[model samples]
Target: MRSLAFTAMLLAAPTAAQTAPEAQRPIAASKIVLVGDSTTAVIGGWGPSFCAYHVTSFAACVNLARGGRSSGSYRAEGSWDLALAEMRTPGYKNVWVLIQFGHNDQPGKPGRSTDLATEFPANMARYVDEVRAAGAKPVLLTPLTRRMFKDGKLQNDLEPWAAAIRKVAVEKKVPLLDLNVESSAAVQAMGEAAADRFAQLPPGSAPIGPTATTEIEVRPMAQPKLSFDRTHLGIEGANYFAAMVTRELAAAVPEMRPLLVR
Candidate 1:
């Protein structure tokens, strides 16, 4: 009887050790990961404010966007790899990745741009697969419209890229946020002069040296008129875009409706 009892005790020890951690393990809920470049990155872009002020308490928000990164480069720089790792980690069973790229995908910069024919959609498709493989959903966002205007019309450079995302969304049956279209319309409605307020600049009190300080220029409603960088919003600008994101997500995801701030 004593020998038999000792063996049972040893078996029970392993069960207790395993069961304790299982019982204490915290449950992981749904989460969203935003992947893109500087335009979508937290802080410098609108993504930070979007995650901070827009979404409700129900979902976890993670923005993995980096400055000056294109879709090709984001993956190449291993940012996507880091994002993939995060998705597979414990408590991310209901993960969703939102991908937005393009500004840098144009054929000017080295290592940043892609051919757009095979390279663009191919990268997007690969991202979809990797996200799904990690047991998460992938949502494609058309690049946001740059606030460039010509003759009272919003000039869209990202049209093809946006179209590509839409195409991928249709093919993969994934959710999409047409930020490109929505933002274009939004900026056009605001017009050239009003839109300039969105761009960033150094504070007025900063000293301006003769060398011509890029940081210390008076930010006019359109002062740097030579360049129409009037579209990229500052913190407030990101908040606006973030609101649009919430609205679109609420409509498409519906289940996400309760998680958005009405």
Candidate 2:
């Protein structure tokens, strides 16, 4: 009886020792920072849904994206500094930054448009370098597709910018989400009338206008008014694209899988 009792005690001792350390061990939390334009910003972009629904409590998700921001203006206006500060914050096990631009980077938008051939790629490479310098991993994302159709075919005006971003990702050897390709294909399959449902408001009878040439001059702390447009996202659009981002992110960075919801 004494030998039997001693063996049982030995087994229980190992179990308790194993579990005690695990119980006392701190859970390593990760931080995700989003940097981009209106397509990734709150209210008008997928960032809200991605943070609200896709991430688990084990992650700190910060959406620093803004409306009408391009790669150039985002840094010029001091937004990149804020994002970099977040990346440098201590105590996170891992930090990841997702960068998407291009809608406002196209020509004609003064103070925002970057020369696609030179400035755009250079800016992206700089961002990747800085993110690494701050001890965070950087993931590059192509711009979300604009939900516009011409003669039943989806118009992918952002392709040039997406190509530039892809080239940067390749040259930098960073993870690329290729959101433009995924989103453009998804929107094309949905067709014109179906895709219209993704707009912030119902698309009326008028034709979708050309891309806005001027950057939206919104106050720093005020919410921008949302109107019916192909460029901005509705809740449906947000949820849809947010799910895409979540899935693609999990795949692109497998270590993030445990922190994300499918």
Model 1 lDDT, residue 26, Cα: 63
- The total number of steric clashes, by the backbone 3 Å criterion, in model 2 comes to 0
For candidate 1, write residues 1-262 as lDDT tens digits.
9999999998777665666754565654677788998778854577887778877666788889987898899998899989998788775447778899888898898989887888999899899999999888888889888877899988888899999889988999898989888888888899966666665532242432234445556642322211224535566677778888878877777766665674
State the lDDT of candidate 2 residue by residue for 27-75, as single tens digits.
8999999999999999889999999999999999999999999999999
Off by over 4 Å in 2: 1-23, 205-224
Judging by lDDT against the true structure, name the best candidate. 2
TM-score of candidate 2 to 2 decimals: 0.85
lDDT (CA) for every model shown?
0.78, 0.93
Q: Which residue ranges in model 1 land beyond 4 Å of their true spot?
A: 1-28, 202-228
